[model samples]
Target: MKSDERMRLMDLLHVLKKRYATKAYDATRRIPEETVNQLLEALRYSPSSVNAQPWHFIVADDEAGRQRVAKATPDIGSLAYNRPKVLQASHVVVLCARNELPESYLTEVLDKEQQDGRYVDSTARDGFAAARAGYVKQHLDAGDVMFWNQKQVYIAQGFLLLAAGLLGVDATPIEGFLPEALSEEFGLEEKGLTPLVMVSLGYHADSDANARLPKSRLARDVVFSKA
Candidate 1:
């Protein structure tokens, strides 16, 4: 690259680095709805087990809904850590995963694939389709899907956090809330959703002190390798 191009790139990188200063926000700044939708849309494309896309989210923007979430959080972290600032933020996206998928849909989709002319033998196709359905049913009954779904949820969470930062919105990833509390309050069981993470989104306060704190990291020797 040319010298001028390299210098320009470095300047842009510095701007990005300075943007994410760990700032704590107050209640005054509100996150826009368009920003929230774009961030969540990024998560919708996240990879999932079998493309099941098991994750779900509950957008908490109303005062009553935020209060319910605040009440459910366990008071164990640093006082500043679990601040209701999240509740006051423009929105709190409660991430979760669906506990179950309808077996009928699974069977029907598989059966349709068998009829899509991918196989040469009609009789053999019936046998193969039946076996696949049985296999899927056995795993679904064994209850190991949650283990796989949890990985997808984390992927979505990572995407959401980065998208928020890229959009110039301040977001905090919170996991201190009681999942069961949220599940019950929202009646998530009926929707087949289980709570996983809470992400609060909004603009940061101009005078918040967290931005001034030094960023910390483990030594490079402990984290990276060139070989």
Candidate 2:
């Protein structure tokens, strides 16, 4: 690789190395409006299986909005530990997965794909649609369609965390909340969405011990294999 390309590769890895799941957030700090918008745009561009885009994110930035989100986090058990992060973080995003994929949503995505020139012509669009539909059917027949969709959502979350880290933002990916409570609080079921995970974004507080800790991971030998 060129020297510039090698430098960029190192820089990106450095960001991942330095970033940690924030344990505490400085409530006084806020991500600017422009940066927040950019983050959401990056999230939308996250790829999925057959481009299903089977996720919706609800963002809470203001106190009232965060408070509403906090109501869904139970005060008992380990979930209570995440409640403060939900409320004190500059923003919290509840990542939702579609409960079911209906024909209407598929049509909607296909329409946008066509409108954006994703296919060269009608024949290509039709071929692409058939290929996507076959994959959807395979998941449906296996009774794991939701799981399949949530896998795509998780991929998007990975993208979001990396993008946030590159922007010098702290984040905490939370999975301890009660999904039922969140769904009810947000009336997500009415919109055909099910809560899957949440992520808090902000600057880290001095009290965040995790931010000061070193990152530990398996050795490259254990994590990779040559084909």
Candidate 3:
């Protein structure tokens, strides 16, 4: 491998090694708006099955919005552990997946593709949309469209984590919150969205106990298999 390419690979591995699920955040310190916007952009470009981007993000940067999300984290349950993280993080992102695909949304995606010069002719545009529609239909027929969409949302979450790491920001992907309560809290149902997961972003407090813990993972041989 080329020296520069090898160094780039090492850099990515280093970033992955350094990142962890931050347990505590420095509430007084906030990630700059510009940096946060870049992180959101990273999520925007995340890949989805058949180019059907069926996800939305709610950025709770304001105190009111954060507090609203915090309400979904009950004080006496499995989700209770994430309450303080929600309240104290500089910002929280509510990742939502579409429950159903409306025709308008399909049209909008195709229209954007045309606008972006993805198709050279009307036939090309229609052909591409038809191919994507077939993929959508298979999921719809199986009554698992929402499940497929949720999988795509997680791809965006992975992108968010990597982007946050590259920006030197601390982040924690949260799945413990109440989905029903969060949906109501954010009025997601009205928008045809279901809250699937959330991620809190901020700088970690110096005394964060999780920060001091060593990282652990399964053995490489156990996780990988040769075809």
Give the number of the best model, judged by lDDT.
3
Which residue pairs overlap in candidate 2's backbone? none
Give candidate 2 misplaced runs (Cα > 4 Å).
none
Q: What is the per-residue lDDT of model 2 for residues 131-216, given as tens digits with 9 covering 90 to 100? A: 99999999999999889988989998999899999999999999988888888888999999888889999999999999888999
Off by over 4 Å in 1: 1-23, 74-83, 104-143
Candidate 2 lDDT trough over 10 residues, lowest sum: 70-79
lDDT of 3 by residue, 83-166 (tens): 989989999999999998777899899999899999999999999989988988998899999999999999999999999998
The total of clashing pairs for model 3 equals 0
Candidate 1 C-alpha error for residue 13, in Å: 5.5
CA lDDT of each prediction against the hidden true structure: 0.72, 0.91, 0.92
How well does each candidate superpose onto the true structure, as a TM-score?
A: 0.72, 0.96, 0.96
Over 4 Å off in model 3, which ranges? none
